[model samples]
Target: MSTRLDDAYQWANSADGPVLVAVEERQDHELAAGSHRHARGQLFGSMRGLLSVGVEEGVWLVPSSHAVWLPPHEAHAGRSHGPFHGWSVYVAEPACADLPRRPCTIRASGLLREAVLRACNWPIDASTAPLAPLAASRGHLAEVVLDEIRTSPPEPLGLPLPSDPRLQRIAKALIDDPADERDLEQWAHWGAVSARTLSRRFVSETGFNFSAWRQRARMMRSLEMLAAGAAVSAVALDLGYSTASAFIQVFRRTFGQTPAAYRVRL
Candidate 1:
């Protein structure tokens, strides 16, 4: 973990409550909090950046339009891909019964976002009652927030990272520069493994061959770049796609929206 994120993690350290909220307004904020567990489940909402959240299953790329729900005691770590502005809502056991049991990213609906943002300002200590009018209302917005999470749509935008050291290094290199068009044989040479060995390892570790993994990496990166306001053609070339049209085809297929459409929605 980077020293900067280590510092950012400080904001996340709080007393677990039936509902606890922490807001981070800095665009460059990030945290790796490490492969640690929290007694309460958490909802991570990113307002303006891409977040790379890692758990036991894999790493998920969360764009600005999304949020991730992590069940209780599930070891996880997170880092920002760019400028990120977000907050977290931690809910203790029974209160989190309605949320997803496994790690998954959900679309942050406007209502859910408002509920979370509102909760951030009020005291979330369930032991004590809130005094604010908005918070003191009879509707009990906290439950509303969790209900919104339960119904929100899930997005299939995560690119799983290989756990094995050799494959992990290769995955990182490719993610760092998706434009690199190195073949499996060339990457095998860099890893000091036979091409056959590397190919076998790639499938076993991530369930995706080299080419497929690279494609997924490129597609995920394109979402981040697009969220940052990059032009279609520029993002395409940056991610090693030959042309804007080709990139558009893949992007449309992967995300079900054109780059322009996606940005407009964001």
Candidate 2:
């Protein structure tokens, strides 16, 4: 664990070209919220396991084959949904100035991944010959990643954070147990706030009404479960839907496709 933490720190500290540090392994932990507002842009690649990245607007999941590219000084936190392993790429700020200002996950094409690996290990030298090809390749790979993110479907999995501490606790509880049937009144009682206040506070912090937020959360959780190959009936049951058909109805409505079809497509 210490060695891996050291590696993470080193990867963050080393800034030359676009550095790619693959997560060789990881154990489960609640990656606390904070920002590493570096001079360079950061791309978090999670080829295995699930991760969550919180930006100013919302929290996004970084699933396998997906990565989040955070523009410099965007104020964000890196979270792991479970155990995670992948690369962390630190792109030169000048090179990444044009990247997306918000959180996004990019496709990891085979060639692009290799280019990132090469760029990460590039050595600083006086000779400008061998470095030219590496620089060109890194630029190409960054372009590919950006293009993929732009074209990829805007997944229905973002659950925005609640800024208020009380509301934040409620949101965290929902994430902990999506099956919880606690109503606004119950949440208010738990939070020691009035129902009206709870409702208003929830909307004020998350930018979505309670039902809307939960629906989005359910959709995101369902997506994660589907990606893990969970059976539709089981997923529905686990998410507290009365029936699989009911869950499928909501899933299709939100995603514009049936869960089975979506899973097959994925």
Candidate 3:
């Protein structure tokens, strides 16, 4: 963790109240708050940029329209790849027991989005804000956020990295270039394993077969480019899809929206 980035951490760890942090990031700015845990749970989201959160299982690709929920004391590391408008709510375990116990990506609805922003505006530590003097007001706002989080639906935007070094070799190759159109047989060379062995290891370590994981990697990477204002056709071609329409079909099936519609919200 960077020394200068302790403002949020300090606020979150201060006393028993909840915390709200708003980040204004630069395109070149990289925030790598290494793997750490807190007594409280956190809800992380962004209005811009990409969030890569790594837990014991794998990494999650958080887009502008999505949020990630971390249960209390769950070990995780987060990094922002580009300049992003990030916001989060940190509440003690008691305030979030109603939410999911697992670390998962959530599809942020309009109500959940506003509730987080509202919490930001009413930081519990700020003395000058209208509700700054009242601790009850802060607790109430956090409760609202908790309710919304429990109601928010989950999304399949996570990219699960395998634990084995052999699988990591293949995973890294695809992450470096999602357009790599190689099948398991072709990728086996990178991992120094037979094609069948690689396939079995992928399932054992990542809970996904080779083909399914490759598509997930491509889709997760597409979110960053698409959110950064890339055209649908360009993103499709960049991700190795034969055509924009074909890419749109997969994207629509996964997110229930086409690239154009999804980017408009960003």
lDDT of 2 by residue, 119-185 (tens): 4454433222322334566566656654554455444335576767787677767776778988889
The list of candidate 3 runs beyond 4 A from truth reads 1-4, 18-30, 46-50, 56-59, 80-85, 109-147, 253-266
Q: What residue pairs clash in candidate 3, if any at all?
A: none
Relative to the unseen true structure, what is the C-alpha lDDT of residue 206 in candidate 3, on a scale of 0 to 100? 75
RMSD of 3: 4.4
**Model 1 residue-pair collision total:** 0
Give the CA lDDT, 0 to 100, for residue 11 in model 3. 50
> TM-score: which candidate is best?
1
Q: Candidate 1 — which residues are off by over 4 angstroms?
A: 1-18, 25-30, 45-50, 59-61, 80-86, 109-118, 121-134, 137-144
Mark the 10 consecutive residues where model 1 has the least summed lDDT.
124-133
Error of 3 at 25 (Å): 5.6
Q: Assess the local accuracy of residue 163 in candidate 3 as a C-alpha lDDT between 0 and 100.
A: 68
Which scores better on lDDT, 1 or 2?
1
TM-score of 2: 0.75
